[model samples]
Target: MRKALPVLLLSTALLAGCAVGPDYRAPALDLPEQWPEHVLLSAEARADWQQWWRQFEDPHLDALVARAVDDNLELRLQLARIQEARARLGLARAEQLPSVSAQAEAARERTPGAASPLGQSSTDNLFSLAGVLDYELDLWGRLAREREASEALLEQSLFAHDAVRLNVIADVVATYFDLRSAQRQLRITEATAASREETFRLEQLRFDVGESDELALRQAQSELESTLAQLPSQRERVRVLEGALGLLVGMTPAELMAELDYGDTDLEAIALPDGVPAVLPSELLARRPDIRSAEAGLIAANAGIGVAEASRLPRFNLGGLLGSAAGDAGDLFTSAAGTWGLSATVMGPLFDFGRSASRIETAEALAEQAEVQYRATVAQAFNEVRNALVTYEASGERVEAIRRQVTAFERTLELAEVRYREGFVGFIELLDAQRALLAAELALSEAMRDRLTATATLFKALGGGWQVEG
Candidate 1:
């Protein structure tokens, strides 16, 4: 009884022993309390890290985004990663659970006459079956900490997958808008070329009748040739853009152009709902995915510190066996043959080549690295939001300016053409006006496309439209 009392007391002490390393506590992030400068932001964008894609009003875009989120290769890979983390958690949990197994064997032995007198003429066979069990006691909470770390990693993977989804959706929208802009430019160039051809004919007639000089004919032809020369390259740009959009949507380039809708009538309207909300930067610590993932990694590293430290202390295990052994199969489990044993052991690393200390140092370094990564992630997020805000606002102003320029240039071209027809001006004057109008038209289409793209970028930066589910 005295011996048993010491063992009991020892067990209690072991269980109460401190976990060797530092406890995990998330470090406080030093972030902005409010926007530092005047930002062109809306009040409607909240800290809902998901659903950033819905800010684009196209139903078609929304549908494509939904499809990609469910099937994108990158997102699927992250999902698989989360599954891996879950498996690791399960293995860690099982560390403290007992393991059971069955064992069986059959054997025969023969002895030579010269070896021993008793075995000189004898041969025997033996068979037995046994049950076995074993378990480890996590007295220092090492296994428990490991399981907790794995669970955190699983959540991190999930959030990472969501980040990928948001990124893909944004790409598709941006590329689709690009394709439309190219299409608009292509059609504009074609129309301008046709107009120049008519002007060339008129100038040729005037030169024949002595109404215009050779220089006028040459300038008119130059404008027509230049406008016509742009057609093939513009067409090529459209094809390239079509292929890009196809890849973004996860389809073949040929297939994308074959069924692409590039007309403004076909393009869906995207309404800018709102801008970044007025929220504390610290609140965003819970919203951003990369930030969350880094935090989880830091937690995992902290847990490893405990795991490594605990290795220096003794670990206890429970071992047991239950079964019967017999020479004859039918005799198994008889009272005389039945047997069972239960035992426990505590083992520790008495000596090592500084492995435990090295592990603790490595874990501390990694946790520190994760902290830096979290800070960097937040900084990058802020940069994106700031850049998106500036671009979106600038695009709105540029579109308006481009439209006005197009209108003024168009009226100028019409007046120059009327003067040339009335014999009050030469072909060069009309050609210059037409060329200016064409550039303005092209510029306007580009500005509109930029506006649409900038809107999508801002929404993505604000984490505007996704609904992430755990």
Candidate 2:
């Protein structure tokens, strides 16, 4: 019976391949076919959204994005998480295989002849060596289900890491634009301040010559000081935004400043795409990383249900030991000195009232939660895309309107300056015109920034940068 046990266990292992509990299937979603009608891109152009930043046609932006990809701390952290998940997957896979160990022992002992029933004293030495094997037969496929769940978790980690990469790219791009916008605004304020100082000097000279009154001179001086005060704040904003961009790219403030070449930085020179491509709402399920991560979680949870169900059934463990034992070392391995044994262990929950039932219930509940979360993620993804589309469209219109307004303000300032020089209008009219022009210029810069940021947001919503395989 002992000799035949190994063969019987092997045959049982071959027959016990079925896993208990439910198999995994993706939950159904009532997805939309198309996005909001106002969005501009044709379905055929969706592929072009990949590498959307390249459309900006700026070398400096390209360099910054590459640096962020290589060194951003958040991205590195996600990569480490991928490694952790991969190690866990390896551990789960190892459980499916047999475990083997080498065991050895040696001893010397003396026995009284009376104790040995020999009526004489005797001494003996014993030595033994054996190789032992232990392996769970996986009768209900518990180990297989565990391995399946682990693989799903690994996939989830990978998708999450990709999501982080996409976010990092978007953050770096948006922050770089913010830095440029601040620099542009600062320059406009500085130019306005210098122009106001010149006006104040001319007003002071005219008042001293009795051509202008104290009231007019003081108004000019007030406008000049107000414009000067704005300079310090604008400069400060530029500095702070630069620091923000530096952190996004994992660089220190000093390093960012040195690399920025602030003197040559030209915010107005960077151009944006005229139109962004649109994608079908249904396609978003495969495109968005967060959605994919959620789905992976669901798969793992579904596998967990099988694992829990399998745990309630009986487990079969097969083991064997082979060795030789004799009074002399030379006699070990001889036919008469050989020894071997095999074992089979069958364990089942005989009296656990509700523990297995509770575990199965818990697994089912978690699986349901994963399904609901997946649906919510998809819904939220669509909402963000819709909002981005609307904002992008409105931002473009605002930029165009501000440009026209700036043009009119420029002409008004020119005419007001002429009228003031001819003494046909008071200095108050000139100051008002100058103030309007400065405000319009600043508004135009802000509008442009918004338009660019809206475009990036739309790209992010559409999951522009990464591809998940079907």
Candidate 3:
């Protein structure tokens, strides 16, 4: 029996090296070699892309992004999930090793006088100390497959955390840009309101002195009131944007209620990035965390098929016990009181109405779902990059066009004012010129905001400067 046990163990060890089911291979994808011809790209170093928000050259924005990375609730939740996956991986690894336990016992019993050969009852004590060992032999590599799946899940968790982190950073930057835009709009409205009020006062004085008619005076007052009416809505927009920015920067409810004080930063002053990185479409698969996370999930599902397949085969377990037994506790360790045991167990599904086969089918179906999801994630990533590139380029062009429009309106307003004062044009013409200039200036402000926000979106779509480590 002893010789046969060693031979069986050696044979099982050899079989353990051969696993059941399919191995994992990365899915192949056909990707473009270059971006569309209309998309602008730059062959620039990506070192600065890691903290892409710093390109705006605003210290306050840099600080806010840093705070969001450290304190965002969503990021904290992902970190906790990572820890849980790590623990599960540890448990899976432990299953591949042996388990040991120690036990000690003491017992005393008295036999009835009638049951004993001697006519008197006697008390006896039994003392024992034992150590037991149990190990599952991976004859079909089931434990190894389980460990592989657990490792992939851990990778999935890590990449998922990175995905959330990328999103949080992007949101903070985009919200900051929006807040600045709203502030700029509010300032434009306020300045226009003040100018109109001055114009109204001058018209009132001219009407009283008979230089301007009541019609001109009433028109000036109406324009002034119209500008005044926009003040409240613009101010409210600024407040709402401020609240959004505060939340993105991870401010508590109390802190937001107290009003976040982002220093006076002008929207126009924010520098536009010169160009975006020129990376091939295939390279995007490596840079994006969401794509990597999806692939990890697929790999895990692939490994699960092996686990299910191995479950239909036999499982071999080896167990052993070494101990000492004696009538007295002091004599438990003596040579005459030694005890030992060895056992081998084989368990497999004999007949359960195809239960094992059903499990294998379920695993296969889940694997197919994961593969489809992976492909969808990759497709979505490419679509976003394409749209962001187009939007960013178009926004820049729009800003330039609006700037030229503002310049032309400013000149027209100046000419109208001069002609009206010289009695060559009516006050109605001057009013139209003033209204056009104000509208153009407001549009220019909004266009500038959109350009900056578009740049941020492009950066996010390109995976925000994250790279896979070697």
- Model 3, span 225-327: residue lDDT tens: 9999998988888888888878877789899899668888888788888877677788888888899999999999999999999999988999999999999
> Between the candidate structures 1 and 2, which one is better when assessed by TM-score?
2
* Each prediction's whole-model lDDT (CA): 0.74, 0.85, 0.89
How high a TM-score does candidate 1 get? 0.86
TM-score of every model?
Answer: 0.86, 0.92, 0.95
Q: Point out the worst 10-residue segment of candidate 3 by lDDT.
A: 38-47
Ranking by lDDT: 3, 2, 1
Order by TM-score, highest first: 3, 2, 1
By how many angstroms RMSD does model 2 differ from the true structure?
A: 2.7
lDDT of 2 by residue, 1-470 (tens): 85687688678868678988788887878877766677565655546556888778788888888888888899899899999999999999999999999888777889988898768899998877788999998888899999999999999999998888889888988887888888888889989989988988998899899998999999989999999888888888877877777777788656866744534456678787867665667778888998899999999999999999999999888888998877777788889878788788989998899999999999999999999998898899989998998998999899999999999999999999899888888889999999999999999889888888898888889886533223
Query: How well is each residue in 331-445 modelled by candidate 1, as lDDT tens digits?
Result: 8878977878877787988787898789878877887887788778878987887788788889989988988998899899889978988888866788778878989988888
Candidate 2 global CA lDDT score: 0.85
lDDT, candidate 2, at 98 = 91
Instruction: Judge candidate 1 at residue 363 and give its lDDT.
Output: 74
> Model 1: runs farther than 4 Å from truth?
1-18, 36-52, 109-125, 252-280, 423-425, 466-470
Clashes of each: 8, 1, 0
